[model samples]
Target chain A: MGLFSRLIAKVKGESGSQISASDWQELERALIESDLGVKGVSEIIELAKKERGEDIESSLTSALSSWLSTNSRQLASNSDRLTTVMVVGVNGTGKTTSTAKLASLLNNDGAKVVLAAADTFRAAATEQLQTWGARLNLEVVAGPQNGDPASVAFNGAAAAKESNASYLIVDTAGRLHTKSDLMDELGKVRRVIEKLTPVDEVLLVVDATTGQNGINQAKIFAESVSVTGLILTKLDGSAKGGIALAIERETKIPIKFIGTGEGAGDFAAFDATTYLQGLFQA
Target chain B: MFESLSNKFAGAFSALRNKGRLKSGDLSDIANEIKLALLDSDVAISVAEAFVKQIEDRSLAVLDDVNKSTNPSQAIFNIVNEELTAILGGSARRIRLAKNPPTVILLTGLQGAGKTSLAGKLAKWLKDQGNTPILIASDLQRPNAVTQLQVVGESVGVPVFAPEPGNGVGDPIRVAKDGIKFAKDKLHNIVIVDTAGRLGIDQELMQQARDIRDAVNPDEVLYVVDAMVGQDAVRTAQAFLDGVGFDAVVLTKLDGDARGGAALSITQITGKPIMFAATGEKVSDFDLFYPDRLASRILGLGDIQTLAETAKSAMDAETTAKFEKKFIEGADFTLDDFLSQLEAMKKMGSMTKLLGMIPGANSGAIKKQLEQFDDNELIKTQSIVQSMTPIERNDPKVLNGSRRARIAKGSGRAVSDVNSLVDRFQAAQKMMRQMRTGKGGMQMPPGMQMPPGMAAPAISKPVQPPKKKSRSGNPAKRALES
Candidate 1:
């Protein structure tokens, strides 16, 4: 199955034009399988049924479009001062890699970018970011291993301010949302950076393949740090990234960017039309 | 905001109450709800559908038989558990060592699936099992992937074979072949090849994995996957099955709150047993996967077996006998008894782990309460109880305003806190008395009810729980009761 094809196939698999009970059930299964979640799928099915459209595909697209907002899709940057983007997420969701990719994107656009290796918890995490910084030829400020991450973010903010950099990307350690202490540490890091320079965007990097718990991750992280946007990573795989839609619906946080592959050039701005087309593509 | 899968099943079957026989409509309703729960947990659509259909058919046939149990839901639950266990491959499968000296194991998965971390954990596990394992850093595709593996190897006290300094520089296939040779020359019994995390659809990288597998000819190829993975689990598992053909599955990041329906999806689709699970970030968090435990967890029944084991170790025989004697005699379960039980609970593990072992304990207000719970609360309760005289400990009814004030002063807590502790203890004592008079009826906290048939077997099924059954009860009745 490609993206929402499992659900779309339900509509196309029917012999007649009119929708049947089994078809509806199959559509429900498809939506649930796509990670829309049981509740979200139930709401969508109810709405689609009420609309009584000519087909199931367009109704679901419209239902999804109603929940999605394209206004906040642009990466917010402060014009009068340095824009600081703080990236955070659960373990192995590619927060560090997304931070590097975001910095590289801003740097490639003729902007001076400084990367902050603030992930002082995970082993070799600092080295991973430093290697990316060295490859991109961007300045990276880091602290000692197992040191305070907030202090490192503060240092990165100071370095960006002193160097007159256009942007400072702070990459925090990957911490599960269930860990309250780790979440508090993230808040402290954000507050420390805010003391030097306000964080313009707190992007919660979510794996495209994450299940229903992705909503919990988004909600809890937003509660901790007021997450400004989402960065959906690992889209090159078989996952359709449906959780992004569900998360956006629940949190009202727009996805500013997406990671298509492992390469630095595989990122692009989130376009709602293109994304919806991919989702509903037959 | 979705109810746990076990809760969903409970809700669906709640309609079956007072019904004499299981109707087809009731069966389909239960099946439909179960299907939704499975999907919510990220099980593949086709697999969930097939599984629900099979269970529905089996349940109908079983219910129509002559040997019908009184509780229809319990019968259905047993059928579902058996089918889930069967689909989960019955039991945990360990690694098959090579007949020759150097056994090779290949690790493969998608990007950010924790292949590198799993490599370290597997190496540490093998080392702990009295085997010399060498980690091969063949993940030359990602930036500094080799450094990450080397750091992991160093922490685990295992040597890493990274012939090429990996920054998209060297051939992983050649490195894997050379790694095996190096391992054999050094007399290492095991060689683990850690490959780059790649897309299942990426033909080039999938071919790279295949080439490495062919070159190494490892004894086992483990497909590591994130437990939080959703619908894509089927597609990716299928892709790997066709592209690189793994021998067993290893689920990582089980520490996360995700229900891990991907375990069911991958296991059922590939017909491969899940061998191990990486629960936390540490190498020591890795262990053999238990299918029965995961099945109950996925169903939202909690890990009763693990909880029983932990409680059995922490709870001594004397305390069990004491508690039993008081219960049968209908004696008041005093604050002192509550304090001892609290101490035993503290010894069992963290409050979070204990709370997680109870059904329906992972949601709503209980979750909030769990977050607020700490050992200090237990200590304060202990202090408040200790401050009381023996008479007051025996009967909290004597805890009037003056005594509570004295306890507050002695425990260094507010009077209101001491008063609340006494009130809670009195409430607990009353509940225990009611349980005794109710003939050992299943007395669960509000909203934490186990399936009717599941309560009795929980203690005996997990491990011998206390083993202080009343000798006066009828033996045959006890058998039926259990």
Candidate 2:
């Protein structure tokens, strides 16, 4: 059978009238087959059964869709003020890329954005952020790659304040979340930013392909710094988007943005309604 | 086998093996091995350090208790397993899907992690289990991803809903919304959306994905990854989790020569279960991942469960039924089946990786030989198969001189190319027949080795016939022959 036919079959499988009670067992199997972790499938089934009656399939679909939409919406809709977003994650998590992307998104929304290249460890990191700044035409305050990241954060906050930018996106050095010294450096950067201006948001940039390991990084980062939101990058390559549901279940962190691709315009804000609609579209 | 890891383990065991007592030095060696393995496998360095430290501390205190056991290897294995299990959590955790009918699954990953492929694979798996799935081609930036996805969708017989090019990545959310409404009108059940990928992690991409998440309101967000990336995959996963918190992880390319150290450590680091594993390129090459099997693979104790899971994940019920039917009918297995089998072998990862999986198949020369026959060659062979006419493909005997010329023209090759293909097919068929008849299986032809490298040979060697000599004619005949 072809891929499209199989997909159609899956969509048809949800038809309540076409399937018998024995076929319902296949629903769990279907979920597992779709890579929706076993626990996740059971959760969905239990939730669906509880709301069961007439039109169980539709009910289950809507229930699952709504549950996700509701949770994600609650997380992303956290107030409309300055909404300072500080990007954090280990090296190579695309922190720099995410920072630039966030700036572009905010700028596109008509908000003046300032980016702080506080990731002063890797030589290429600063240059990369600078290149992004040039492409997006956004203001960037960067320290030398080997310089103190906290200094960059302080300067960036000052620049944001002077420029009257609504959102100050700070790109911190990519350090292992489990490293105490690195976490301390991150804390210091946060302190510097707070001293310059109130630190409103802490966003952790995670590579979606790492599966649960990404979540583990989140846990450690959250411990090191009180992370407020998540930006899941590389959604385009990740086959198991289930990690988002898993992360939310484990950490209750709201995913603010998802990086679908490398393009500056590829980032999108998390929307619940469309997500629900997309889930059952098949 | 844990070829490299075995040496490390050997070093650790040797220290503890003869000492009749466990020392800090032995514990340190074991800890070092864990750290090195984790790092090599691409576990975040910090995570590796902390993990090794914890193991060291625990082992130091429990050495006396563990040393009392007669089997030192077992004791070490138990300890390592315990440490690994502790770090990874006791068991796997599952994602939290919505109670509604269309449970949304959002995929995220790095550019080369195969997220697009996973989306199709997942959709196919869902269809097999009797669910209706709509595949959304939301990856708007990458070159030809939508088309690739459409091809995948078509192959799986699933309908794909994609926004027009330049419509923006988030446009798919709106399209998906409309698709859902359409499905509702038509009563479709599930939708799987394929998103974009970046060369590296960037905030703009995350925001776009987040925007899609908001727009679509997906139930489960999965982080897809390439397991062969080792520690890099783990670090990247952590970054994504921090940015766009996902529900579970789907590890792809498990068939590669990855020690699977990242998979084992990722769960412990993120406190999330590896929901699924992708072992091959085929849509069916996905399995509902189990932690124990992964642990066993990491420890170099062959994971039969994982192997079975890989087969089950890759082969759909329909394909399996077809195979069963063919077996019952005692039908002649054709070249097409052989080609598919070869393709499947390629999907199991690099030749070196497959060899590593088999017991005692690890040898330097074998690894090099396996490396030679890579995926590129498989693709070329597939193209060659595609080039043949239906009759020519089904029956090699049908290709006479005229047919060979026609096929060569159609396939954009020389006549000799067609003849060689026919010969190879015939040879393969004969070998298959022999094997089926319980005769000796196919052996390597003299002086011919499986070509290494996926690229086609730069120069084709002309076919040579066996030379004959008349020994009875003595010196004159020998001179004449010379």
Candidate 3:
């Protein structure tokens, strides 16, 4: 059963008149299981209990949707100047794939785009991006193996400016946000891009299945490189991506896109209403 | 980000502290709190509820006999700990090998689950254990998946069987079946078939996994799960169990500060043992999973055994002998020795990770203290030691105020920072002296202390497990020793 249906069943127990303690506990569990985090769950539960007289579903929806931003989930870009977009996250969170998808996305939108393979740490990371660039038929700028990532970002920015591209999506190496040295490298990548032109959007690609640590990842990435938006990837799985709500609630950085599958066409803009409704759907 | 579930568990039990007798209401409250704790750690709702129910039943039984134990909370604690350990698979399980010549091991999981990297780690691990293992790149779904596997295989010095480059051009089932045949032909005793990461609900992909499974009839199918996975763990684990039927589980990205409640959920739902854990990004960061150790970690009691084992593994033979002699002769642990220890500890992994393994290190003041500590702290220490003269490093006693200031200036750190490093070193030196006489009871790394109630397992001296000899004839016992 969907989480909402299960929660409704929990509420409609026996006489179906009043919500019992066990029902509240069930609601809490549902939220916790969705990676809402202990603190986030408790806050929602407290707000939920305070509005017990009203429709539970509507009350919960309002509470959750309030945490999410209704702002435009579109990728920020500059029409006159080059728009530099940096795709970054920890290892294997689909940063490269999402970068390819985003590049294809912008390219289909009738905008000139260039790709940069700034991920030099992981073997075949550049090749991964290069392959995507080849499929998309877009130019890809990559650095030497194990070379400094910032220099690659620098070259990518140069290429984008030279080509007069509308967007330059720099795919950075996946590094754990907790690693200080690696985070420093990410900051340098940003600084290098900003040195040439202002970075329009720094999207942190998060896996849909990430737990409470998602909040920390968002916070650290935002702090390190001023992550402008979030791209929730791997949503093709059964995971509800509820952590995105918690992250948006905490960081106020809206999720720009959702990756439903491995294919480039599976990318879509985030819709808060659809997401909130989907959360409870069976 | 990953709050120690043990801390929450302790909070639950603390309510019943100092009570002469236990009531049913008390047990219920504790049970409720425990359910929340488990849920907070990303344990599936049904699994957490069932686990709490077990705790409630066990606690009520103990309540029936009031005089069974002096401490009711301790009794409950033991019950929860034992139950958790039992559910996590009470003993470590080895990878089951086939009776035939080439043992086919199929790796399956969702995308970004670290299957490609783990295949290499598994191959290298098998190679180290005197087995010829070859990796087969059958993950033809994701872009550059084949290249990733080939790169990982090359790094581990294992041959990869990739007849066709991935990117949806080749049939994975054919590759897997052909890879098994190739392994047999090449006389490779082990064939690790790396498959595409797919969602459990995708029928086509699920059928693909079944096709590969039926084609090669792998001896062991390992479900590679990301340790940071949340509530969907139950559904995904159940799907894989029913759809593909894995023999065991392997947890990846364990180095992240996630509670790893998915471990509990998967094992409980699928009845599979988690055989290995990929702790860090490095291929060598992989290790055999220990249920008792993970159980303790889940309960917020630090994983001291793993930490000690890591320390033992990180230390070279010469360093071990040197420390052993110095420890026995009651010699001072100089700055030079301290510097070397610091460097070796760096090889052990992150300082935050090391401290995180200590009991109560995740809580209040200790956690605050941990914020000041990171890998950078080790780099600073290395630079500080390098700034010192040979004499000063050999004998810290010769270092005067001017020399300390000069060293701090040379290291580009404040004089107070230098002083703190020296103070920490001296404290470590004193602790080493106390340890030699068996008086260093339950102390942690310098500036950290074990919380009052949590008694660290008595590691009187550095546990130096003999790396060369196999004292135990039993394979499992020997595996633990190693």
What's the true lDDT of residue B241 in model 3? 89
| Residue B422 miss distance in model 2 (angstroms) | 20
B77-124 in candidate 2: lDDT tens per residue?
677766666665466665454576677778877665668778888888
Clashing pairs in 1: none
Please give the ranking of all candidate structures by lDDT, highest first, separated by commas.
3, 1, 2
TM-score of chain B of 3: 0.85
lDDT of 3 by residue, B1-482 (tens): 24568778766667767665788888898888887788778887788889999988988877866536777677777888899999898899998888986998999998888899899999999998999999999999888889988999999999999998998899999999899999999999999999999998999999999999999999999999988888888888898888999989999888876778899989998889999999887878888999888887777777898888888888998998997898788888788777787778879887677778888776766666665554576677788999999898876666567887899999999876665565445556666777778886647652224211111212211221232233444434532432
Instruction: Give the better candidate number (1 or 3) by TM-score.
Output: 3
Indicate whether candidate 1 or candidate 3 has the larger lDDT.
3
Clash statistics: count for each candidate: 0, 140, 2
Alpha carbon deviation, residue B237, candidate 1 (Å): 0.3
Winning model by lDDT? 3
Q: Candidate 2 — what's its lDDT?
A: 0.63
Evaluated at residue B313, the lDDT of candidate 1 is 73
Q: Give candidate 1 misplaced runs (Cα > 4 Å).
A: A1-30, A45-60, B1-3, B308-350, B358-368, B375-482
In order, the Cα lDDT scores of the candidates are 0.80, 0.63, 0.82
- Model 1's CAPRI class is medium
* Model 2: share of real contacts kept: 0.01
